[model samples]
Target: MKIQLQTLYNEYLNIKWKRGLSPVHTEPFEYGLYEDDSADLFLSGHSEATFTNWMSELRPEDPYYGSKPNGMPVLADIFNQLDVYDELVLYYLLFTLNTTMSIHTHNSYSEMNDWMKNYSFFQLAQLNGLSSLNDEQKGELRDFFFFFYLYTHPVNEETLYACSFREQDLIHTKTNIKLEHYFSAFHDHYSENRDKYGEQFLIAPHEIQACEQLTLELLRIIEGKSPKLSMPSEEGLEAVVDLINNVEQMLQMYAKNRTLVFDVMRNFLADPRTGLYRNHCFTMLLQNYASYILYFNFDEIHALVNDFRDTPAWCGIIINKIFTDAIFIHKIMRKNAIDIREYPNVIEFFDEQAREFCL
Candidate 1:
């Protein structure tokens, strides 16, 4: 809820009453102080002596306290006027739900179909602002107060952590699957207008510089060394240096081999022989690239490519091998009559997650 001084004051008064403090005069301030303690009003009004003189007989610690008039106003009466506080609380709660609902947020809003009746807290808040908060706003406050908790609290909350009131119908698109196409189109357009780009072809020199740093880092990670430029051993160092030299030579060799490089990428995606190698590489490449964007460093991708390329073939081989192993494992386990579906929560959540990702 949007924090406000008025509500804070009301809550503060509530806490005071709970602590057994006197919050109000036996009569309204309109009548001023009671006749018995009339002189105690302004002489340091908050002093212990001030409280003692006015309420000393009713004091809980007094020797004969039970006989006193017990002249304090009830907490329920002071707290009964809380429309302003309730409205502010509901608005803040709804505001939190408006964020973190994901792209599927619009899929379940219909559940709040009675939002117009119960959730007019948000509406009236927008219309009249807090100025309309008074005895008249009580009906609106009571209706919407509970729903502020209901709709925003996720269904199957053991799975979802954030507060997200879902919308009625969620529309899914192949956004992630299409990222490759978009990035490739951008690269192609950039390549076509190299003259216009002038200093922007960003080839040759960048490849050389990036390769130098990337190779040293890759060698360190490949050998499981710390992040540094030092090559620890002569034998391993020579192999590392040679790999860099071959990669540079291959770059020059492939200068006119755009067709070959692209064919490699396409096959890498399609898994011409089997899908496991390509899938593993896909995970490695994707995780590395995602981390690179966030961290703005080559360490992640460089380490990923290093470890991923350790097999006989690069990306395509690992993906195929992993998938083959997974399928074999599944079949053998099934033959023994042990079903993975026995773990219902894991199975269901993963199935739904797969559907969502594929969607």
Candidate 2:
């Protein structure tokens, strides 16, 4: 029997959040297995006591877990166990479910957050089995994943990383998969979605360019390799502020190298001799960038606020902005269930600034 991939995918989505199918772990990088009954989430309208049982009839041996014990099922041999269509359904479920259940993250650096690693592990597993497919099957599989990535993930979040992973997967697996084979189809898919869905389907190019430029300059200054930077133009300043205002864009920028950017900003704010702090435009940029520093590294920001030294009175504006951002980020982190121990006690820092700035 031929199985339609989209129909199977829709069916999986329906049962993915059913009572017994939810993942057992919610912590970052600590993805555990779904409940035993989750096997039915992909069992083509059938149910099984466990994922292993669901696959027992299809494979010659028991499915083994990958790097993470008891995390997700991995079959070493998928060459001839199932028909081509069923294999597509199986691979789709493996990839989509792994991404959905893992801790949601924007960081592409696996060392900082292994959420991508967890998702890519199963992805490589699926790619390893692609050697058995013909050109048509390979094209279908690529489109299946490309469409899903666009459908579920926002462009400002994981889109770039997803694109990177697909390219890297080819190298890692050494399969005959031709990325160019699907480029036209992928663009058409995105265009169709954009046409149907409107602005939510778009990425603002100007905002991205501004973020890239600002991030590069900040990185240069922190490394003591100044680029003879000039103050941003009035419009440039507005673009920078716009990038900061959009949390998803800010996250996309930070995911490049969060720790390095945090360190750069922390050092920049701590030193009083940084002449840029004297320029009105530079000062505004500093104030806005500090907000992101606080958003990403509350602990370091807390220390920066506490370690303030004697400086020009105008520096108070930067301090005030930091304090305000701390309050805002604290509430945001709490609302999103982000576990940041430094957030609760941050009010004291803002309180001190409130008095000093007479706000």
Candidate 3:
């Protein structure tokens, strides 16, 4: 049965998003597989742009190049599009503790939405008319130590964590992780240091090719059994390895996916290749996703780590690095003269989160 709108809104608070229609709390359900069922009504009445052409339903000017049911105009699907939803979902994740888009910041998520609807076009005009500076000035603007940290200081560092990603194929390929090699290394280390660390390393396949297994066993185990859920390394040992693997995967994806890579490249190219932002951005972004991806990974990890509350320190070294990289992105966007501020929610999110994840 189709769920009611109010009911869905309540469910969103619980991080319950619908499949196909919604862009709600999604995770690494099964590697590359992804789905969300949020009804388009969550964003009802927020559609002001009146874009008929951008809809997914319409045919491109050339039928040979573009075609079919996806060709149908999705005028109502603006907020439903992946790119648009990525921004909001990222925004939802950054500011609030809960996974869903709340009614207000602290006072109310619902009130915030109501207030935003009345936000004037005149105010938007004021923001859009601003001029751009050269790269140096942009760099200054993106500084966390200067802009954000000054804005929210004395929060001091917390625990650290390292999150990483790798495709199963790369683990066996020329990339960083060789297949099964990590398990072996971790096993040897744990075996030798049994007196110092009582932890046991475990391994699982990234891709379970058994179509019969998902419904039959994995669900029962995850839902019924308590699994280990810590960062896996306190000294940045395995975490560092995962970090390296994750970075390699991002680079690989960048090399393979020219569109997104070039979007970043063009942003970087806007400025002179001298600043810290331009130099190691690949590393910077690698660090960012490593932490953010954890949004989806943390609960599973938490369930796994439920038994080990006082385990070794957990600091997100990678999370902090992501902040710096994001600042660089915002700086470059400013330097290159993009109207990113119009997307305040996105800018604000990157601004608020960049340095704060220093754990």
Q: Give the winner by lDDT.
A: 2
Task: Give the per-residue lDDT digits (tens) of candidate 2, residues 132-172.
Answer: 34445444434433333334432322222233234223211
Q: After superposition, how far is residue 121 of candidate 3 from its true place, in Å?
A: 32
Query: What digit string (tens of lDDT, one per residue) describes model 3 on residues 70-124?
Result: 3422122322332322222222211211112222222344332222221110111
Summing lDDT over every window of 10 consecutive residues in candidate 3, give the lowest-scoring window.
154-163
Residue by residue across 16-131, what tens digits does model 1's lDDT show?
22223334332101112333322221112223222112212311232223564443322113333323322223223222222211111123343222222212222222212223
Instruction: For each candidate, give its TM-score against the true structure.
Output: 0.15, 0.22, 0.17
Instruction: After the best TM-score superposition of candidate 3, give how far the Cα of residue 134 lies from its true spot, in angstroms.
Output: 43
Better of 2 and 3 by TM-score: 2
Give the residue spans of candidate 2 off by over 4 A.
1-183, 186-298, 307-345, 349-359
Q: Mind sharing the TM-score for model 1?
A: 0.15
Sequence-dependent TM-score of model 3: 0.17
**C-alpha local distance difference test of each model:** 0.28, 0.33, 0.27
